[model samples]
Target: MTHRVLAAMIKHETNGFNRTPTTLRDFRDQNFHLGEAIPRVYRGTNLEMGGFLAAAEREGWELIPAVAASATSSGPSTDEAFEALCMPLTNTIRAAGRLDGVLLGLHGSMVTASHDDAEGEILRRVRELVGSDIPVVVTLDPHSNVTPEMAARATAIVAFRTSPHTDQAETAERAAAILARTLRGEVRPRVVLARRPMLTGFDGARTHHAHGPMPDALRRARALEAEDPGVLCVSIHSGFSRSDCRAVGPSVAVTGDGEDPRFRSIAESFMDECWARRGETTERVLSVAEGIAAAREWRPGEKPVVLGDYGDAPGGGAYGDGTAILSALIEAGIPGAVVANIWDPAVAAQAVAAGAGATIRVSLGGKHDPEHGGGPVEGTARVVAVSEGSFVFKGRYGTGTRGHYGPSAALEIGGVTAIVTTKNKGIYDLEQLRIFGIEPTAQSVLAVKCMHGHRAEYEPISSRCLDVDSGGITSGDPLLFPWQRVVRPIWPLDPVEGGTP
Candidate 1:
């Protein structure tokens, strides 16, 4: 019998504190393709959907494309937006008769207006449509908040082991392979999950440092998978702390070949590792002033000095409108520097309307959360270049996947060139700047709005990169945010039994 499998993707990372509600337009601006368009856009690409296509071809299963939609991380998705995005996936499953299996590409840290555990809700809906008999497999980012409901609904789950997430396609292939084997009557898979009471851990999932706590835990996870035939896959999630949900923290999920008590034990053992190293961090955060000083003092030889504007990163769901770094750079009169993007839609539109070569007085960035990252920079901007802000990723991360910055322009102000963008996207690929007429490789200093994802592409072209905790919602420290929904007595937040962190 020829097996039929359905594959779909709807990935988003929500920042609960962001007042801006993520909408359908946001998905469209990034990458939204339904039905045949999904395969057309993603085929042979580095995205997870590309892996799904390859798996189906390898397994000789009839591939059914549902939808492929993803948005750069931002505020919690609106109810209407969430429903619209999920409808295509659920609808495809509802109509896919005699479906043998389902493969999903998802980010585990998604939070919507109606659902905190958005991945769980998606699985629940899929289970409702397909019933429990059909094997379902999911691919996730390492920064997912692994909820109990997600484990209960899916047969098997896999996550990207790399922090820079250069292994998206590889991770998807792993999950799809499991689904194919299940359909072929090779194995019965079930996911068992375990988590500690901490709000965040695993050095925020940074695998750049090979000997870090995350890497150590992953080694053990891989060892467990190799040792036991029953262990299908072991996923260690560092969790996304920007989300204000009960399940918003580090976790371990062990996908066992069948029901067994050992799966939980294996998961718990991994969770123990996560708990023990809850206070660890991967990056040395620098103040805005210090970061600016470093950039000013850069003696450019081979590569540019990159400063990670981490606190206001769009990747971690911050507004990305923080002016702290840009302001400091301007104040220091740093030359040959470019800030890839400042997410101020209005200012971007204004610049585009004025066209290139037009000089205009503008209040740049810090409009969203002025209190956090130095309330806006006021200056006369010379519009050097303007663009519709669309390009394809050319780096190790998301290669060939198309992205849009909406309306964008390179505004030269106070000896600094700031790329003002209507849409917010983290700099995973150098093309994000190159397309906007700002070649990062030739610049003296580059201020990128991302945490770890940028490392894959940007680090090679940088003399040194420093994480700048130029304040916003997505700052490195989870301790800074006011707790509300997370389960109490969590380590690093509350006293661990009788001891302190």
Candidate 2:
């Protein structure tokens, strides 16, 4: 008998510190496709849904696409938006009558105004509708906060092992394979989770395997699966620190066939390794002044220095309007320095009105929160170029997806040129700069508003990459934000003695 499977994706990584409330328009702006529309847009792409489509074709399974929705990482999603996204998935499952299994693409750090553990709640609703007999397999980002509720509801949870998240398609394929095996009665999958009392940011999660600890942990996970026949899949989640929820921390999930005592031991061992190297995981960041000084020391013949403003990374729910680094670079008169970019719609509008080559006086960036990044910088700038803001990704992540930054302009203030845009986006590709006529390779310094996500693209062309602590909502220092939800007694917040909670 040909098996039928229901597939959908609803993902968003929330940052409680952000004041903006995510709405339905955000999902629409990013991607919101229903049923057949999903495959049409995602087919042959690097997205997780593309993998599901490929798996369906390869396995000869009847695939019923429900809805594929996601928004840029931001503040907690509005209750209405959350319900609207979930309704389509649940409604589709209820109307389908019967299914062999369910496959989902989820970001485990989702937070809505009504629920802290939104992914878990989504799984519960799906479970209530489909019942426990049907296997439910989910593919998640490695940065997810894998909750116990989520682990309990899912038959098997597969997450990307890479930090830059180049393995989205591979992770989804693994989840699809697990679901197929369960449907064929080849294996009964069960997931076991173990978490450490540690909370670290993105710096330590880099998966190059040469310098970072994450690669070693991943190797251990792979070895355990190879050693034990019962082990189906092992995922290590670095967890999103921006999410100030109770389940905010790194964890390890071991999926295996039926109940196995070894699963717990393996998971615990993985968590132990993470806890043991907790100190090495935190990133050592430089201040805006230090970053500018480093740029000043660079020579023209050497490869450009990439200065990452991690605090203002839109991927981590920051406003992307912080002006600390930009103002400092301009003040220091760093020649051939290009910042890609500052999110200021008003300034972009002014530049467009002035047209190219017209000099205009404007206050740029730091408009969202003055207290965070020293307010906006008011100065006269020469508009070098203006664009409607549209480009295609050539990077590992979102390789084929189209990106927009709204009305944008290239402004030259003193010696530094800044790309000002109406919309906020984390730097993911060289195309973001190249489209605006700013060649990153030619510049002496490329200041990017991103975290580790930019490393995949920038590192290849850069002589050196440095993370700067230009204060914003996404600051690397977790202590800067006031926390009310996450469980207490976590590392850096409190003392972790003997590497145990």
- lDDT of each residue in 370-395, candidate 2, tens digit only: 88865888888999999999998888
How much lDDT does each candidate structure score?
0.87, 0.87
Candidate 1 lDDT, tens digit per residue, 151-216?
899899899999899999989899997897788788999999987777788888899887888999
Candidate 2 segments whose C-alpha is farther than 4 A from its true place: 201-203, 499-501
Pairs with backbone N, CA or C atoms under 3 Å apart (clashes), candidate 2: none
lDDT of 2 at 44: 77
Per-residue lDDT, model 2, residue 266, is 87
Candidate 2, number of clashes? 0
What TM-score does candidate 1 get on C-alpha atoms? Answer: 0.97
Off by over 4 Å in 1: 498-501
